[model samples]
Target: MLALYLLAGIAVCLYVYVLSLDGPESYYCRYDNQTHYNLARHFLDTSDWSALHTGSGAVADEAQTGYYPAAWHLLVALVASATGIDMPIVMNALNAMLSGVTYPLSSFVLMHALFPARRDALFFGAFTSVGFACLPWVLLLKGQLLANLLSFSLTPAAIALVIAYVHAGARRHWKGLALCSALSVGFFGVAHPNGLFTVLVFLAPFVIHRIADAITQSTWIGSRNPLRKPWVVWILGLAFAYLVWQAMLYAPPLQQVVLFNNTGNLNLSWAESAYAAAIISLYPEQPPQWALTLACAAGFVALVRQRRFWLGLPALYMLVVYGLCRCSDAPYTLRTFLAGFWYSDPYRVLCCAELFLIPIAALGLATIAAYAHRKIDRLSWKGSLALVAGVFALVNFFPFYQEPPEDQSSEVSGSHFVPTVGTAVGYMHYLMESGYDEGEEQVYSAEEQRFVRKVLEMIPGGALVINQPHDGSAFAYGLDGLNTYFRHIDTEGTTEQSRTIRDHLSDIATDSTVREAVRNSGAQYVLLLDQGLPYDEGRWLIQTGEDYEMGWEGLANLTDDTPGFETILADGDMRLYKITAEESAEDQ
Candidate 1:
């Protein structure tokens, strides 16, 4: 049964990978393309698997500074080492495989924990394996899928460990369970801080159950106990393990959480929860109608019976989602929801709760079956209801497909593609090959292409080239040069010298100081866009220009421009500036 489930899961993963590679529109190509490219480059160049450190790339100035957990990176690096394949392709394939492994493993563990006495664990496992929300995010190429997979796999094992400790009343089991819990929590924390939030929410019910057990201990004295009481030993073991783990694994990075908080606020909205719910339950395009109907029936049963015990997962999920959505004053929109999703996506938390619901829904259906059996013909009624549920579950799995939208252009750039999803597939291959085929090679545009050609002739390799009149030109021409001067000025450790350069550029159109600052900043050539004057404050310098003329206003005051700087080439709207000096005074 497990083998069958594994095979099915792998088949689905491969299908999704093929779909992802179809186009950049289906994946998050633009949103995270630069970051993923840089990270892959780092892994290939330095052989360092730690995502915590910044990559040595063009975007390092803007990249996140904290350490990312090593799990995904290690997998990607291992694959690269073995096959000598491109890091991007390897990472995508690995993610696809991981996604396949998680669904069945999670379902099996969950069934074992929830229905240990039932002989039909496999049946329940299959039901959960096909549920709508269990592994929905696996379609994407993001870290979230990996994080979700780890959490799902670890969560069930942790729950099973806890159940065993409670039922066996053994000190050894309690110790082992405590250790498992700590490790699970640690991995969830490092995988994504949001996983930590979900883990806490899941544990809340267990904590309450423990307290209640202690308070009602006397009431159970005369009863035959189905579960054991090794509470004292378990608590002590967990506490000791937590202390050691905190000091060794969590402390270093946690200490800097406060530092990250200020810059981390990407306000999210409540609408995301609603959007996710709609997609999961009622999307007209690809509705999981059977699953939705089953969930609705189960929810009705839970609500009518005031099943607080069974409500733990759903209730906790609602609380967390509501807290994230309502706590902030951010505008309520899909973009906001996606932005704040970096902290945690409520859609994901709801998916985890959905896993817990399969059993609840199955049990509800089973109860009805048993009732009909007693009322009518015992065997026949029970068999009929079971058959109905099985049919519904199968329906949820069989179609297993999604259609490409009719309007491809409209679909490509929007929220449709998530960054992780795009990178996992081969969408990036198109981008890298669309214009320039060689790394650091420049492709010339008619007017702007001329300027680029000239600049390349003048500027020395590794020189700090700044465009005085075009900010977006470098990307347009595939020039790999520093272009985020305004952003760099806002960086945490902005030197006074860098700040002076920024302030000068802010009003470059009217300020001679701006021109001198540009000259001082080591720009050898200036391309002035014809659409904007040299004094136009709106114009920002860049490596390419669609319609610009070369200027030498700032060059007259500089001594030895030949060795320190020179205009090496020029054509139409572009010009090349070269730095001749081995070391500038400012650099010294």
Candidate 2:
């Protein structure tokens, strides 16, 4: 039975990562995957396990200094080193395994801990873990939120450990459980602090109920010191977890990286209607998938009908936290502070909601199976097989969840989550669509990518290549280890010379100041996708309009006729220009 469950997990992983598993390139290159891949590549190239900087120059001079959690990238680097696999392949496989295999096992552990006797509920829940598209599919692909993905995988295990410790037999070895719980939470906090928040918010009611039970039991026994309870063990365990987080914060390798950033309130506030939409669908931009949505409703009904208040309380409390996190722009300072704990991020809160929903959906499945078993006693075995088939179909083929109704044109209503097509023909079509440059979703055309590869082959390994962040050149660093000037969309901490080159590179033919800036900046070449389409200005994802303002326009104006530039390569609108060292020196 366990082997069967493991196979199911593997199948789930294969479904999502089939493209990358068979190919050398990573999927979802249009988003942050490039930056993350670059970080891992840096670790691999330098062989420095302690280094956190990517040398992308998105932050400070000649290096990226803005604080980002890179432990996830470090792990990817280590795995690639140990396995002798390519970094992109390792990233895809590791993510696939984490989300597909470990996630289901963790869910099983949590469900088993919650309802020890209900094997039907736990088993059904584990099987359906892959079907929650809001998680492994939608959220994973949208921003390629790698760090958040790690934390999501670890959260259920942490929650399950806490449950085990609190409910352990009096004679059982709880010290070990406490230690494990602390480590689970400590690792979770270091991976992504939002995960620690998820555990605390989800389990707050559980601990309070335990303490209340202790008080009531003591009162019935006529104990005078009811408030002076013996629940100090749990409190101490939590304190130890906090200490672990603090120690990791100041550790030798991670001391320089600030875990939190003061992200100001900009598009963080969730309108009431948007919040309602998210709750109903549990997805970012689309309407609810009625199949899973109805199952979740059934799970809620089962909890209430079965009088499972212990499980119901925490599940309900998570929704309350989800609601509170939407108050990013509330007038009350305290309420806003509550929202800030989550960075007022909607996706993080949605992840928290899914943690509880998985088990509830499983309960719904279990309930349906039970009713079917009673109605068809002679065909119980056959019915069970049919139920499994239905689950597999729903996991991969349910198509009722479409883009928001055409009439709906709200800010949050645009489609962001693209579901994986189960059929080979459909998947092939999906790939074709993703590679089409005419669409706003794709970042580069096939010709542009080929041009970039040829340019990388021509340039020496260490030579600096100036690039517009919105164009295909932004991927050069990660794609072929090229030294690109712009690592991300923003020029947050770039040097003055790089800024000057960004804003005036087109004037290299006429402006001595621009030529001098280029010479001082040590730029050897410029790469451009002059006629390429940028991402949609109206989309809620990373806004590219700022990229234009930052300098893409200046870079786009370069041509073969430009005096100080020599066209080294050109494929359609994509061009690579070599800087004329003679002109640069004369200008100097």
Candidate 3:
């Protein structure tokens, strides 16, 4: 069964990846993950263990280390460094590896915690994988999200530890269990900066329960009656105080690294919010929504009656939190903190709830299959599960077998995740052989390729290059150059570059002002998008993929003939401009 879990996990990951490879394109993910990949590449190249770039920069430098979560990238870099494997390959395996770890742990939790007599670990593993096979967030955003998925995967492990400790049946083991919980939480704190926050938030009910247990047994140090007495309140009071102290110590430093995009209020109806939460559907394009809704409902009801439901409480809590944020009339501070903490996007509630959803929905499948097992004579429950898994595989993925969606635009409007296999193969071959030039518009043209390489060739080592609306392209594949004047800055803007550049460059308030600002920032060259825009802008999954007017300004003014701009190269639709006073005066 353990071996089956391993194989099933790897097989499912490989199945999608191999299919993804069927249509070869320069980018594994059409839109996102470039920033994360480049960031990992930087860590590998620099051997620097401190600070990560929220956006690209020419003179990429580390800021306060503890403020930002670098542990996730560090793990990716370490594996790539040790094995000398490509980042793409590592990324390909990133979620899969974590998810693989997750399946077994989840199964163990389900088995020991829920269905020990079912002899169904294998079913649990396979069913769970298939149950989430069509997840939009996992598939649609693929490489874009690192910490969310990692933390979500760790959910099973965290819950498993808590459940195990509770059931450990030894008083002495409680100390070890406490230590384990601390270690688990500490790792989450490093893995995702807000990870411990999620764990603490989710584990509140359990914590209160444990307090009650201690009080009932007269073991609580301060509490004689945890339930009815004020002692429990005192315990909570101390916890809050400690949290406040930790926040003061940690938050300011994190402020140095984290930037929150303005996540405003979302006034969704209760039904709409609950529906989205039930489906865990952040990106509607990735999979059919009704499927998830149906499955999640089944699992929710099935788990509600079992001991495992308690285990899912944290996940359930996150879902409730998401619902609260969706309420327009919801308290400002509470919604703002929860919603803002989640990329300032309300739909990210789905991400926080992902781990919780996985086990719940999977158990829904097992519940149905168990019913079949008892009722059906010829087909075993495992067989029914396998059949169900096979059906889900086809239903979820069958859409992509047809023509792939063109670029990111089609991905949003259409019903599929990526372009057709044929599309990828042809594009890759064309770029490798000829490079994009003339009318051959694909994701990127070869001229821009040469232009970017030339920029790298000319720029001094460690020098920053500015690309407005910094698509992970320049840094993802560019010549040993990074740092951005405009574009692709991660939220929670804290870096010196992000703050400085964002003010002047965020909006091209004045072309001349931006030009002078670029020159003043010590930037020698800028990759101006004479033509080209991302398939999606400011738009991402939580909005159900909504495009917004671009936040990067000054593109309309980036004419080669404009002041402070000398055309170094014009490749395909993109133009490279040199930033110098002499050129600006000439252009003016």
lDDT of each: 0.44, 0.61, 0.52
Tens digits of per-residue lDDT for model 1, 1-588: 566557655654554443444332122222122334334445555676665674433321334455654455556566777797755466556655655666556566655655667534345455545444334443242323454554554455555555566666646577777777788667765455544544444455555555446544757554454333545434654576456434533346454431222222223344643443433431112233445455446544754575335334544354344334322444434223322332334345445556555555555555545555677654685375666456654655443343335553324633322222221112222332322222222221234434544454554653455443233332321122222222221234534444444334333434556545655555444332222223233333332243332332232122223344555554433434444332354454
lDDT of 2 by residue, 450-540 (tens): 6777876898877888887566556666655677777676566677777777677888767778877877767788887654434442222
Better of 2 and 3 by lDDT: 2
Give candidate 1's error at residue 101 in angstroms. Answer: 1.0
Best by lDDT: 2
- TM match of model 3 to true structure: 0.66
Model 1 alpha-carbon drift over 4 Å, by segment:
15-18, 23-27, 30-37, 48-65, 119-122, 138-153, 210-290, 299-308, 311-316, 319-344, 362-386, 393-395, 398-588
Per-model TM against the reference: 0.57, 0.78, 0.66
Question: Residue 216 deviation, candidate 2, in Å?
Answer: 3.9
The deviation in Å at residue 161 for candidate 3 is 2.5
Off by over 4 Å in 2: 16-26, 50-66, 169-174, 218-280, 284-287, 305-307, 320-338, 374-441, 508-516, 531-542, 546-554, 583-588
Ranking by TM-score: 2, 3, 1
When 1 and 2 are scored with TM-score, the better candidate is 2
lDDT of 3 by residue, 491-551 (tens): 3444454444444442332345554555556766667543454445321223222222244
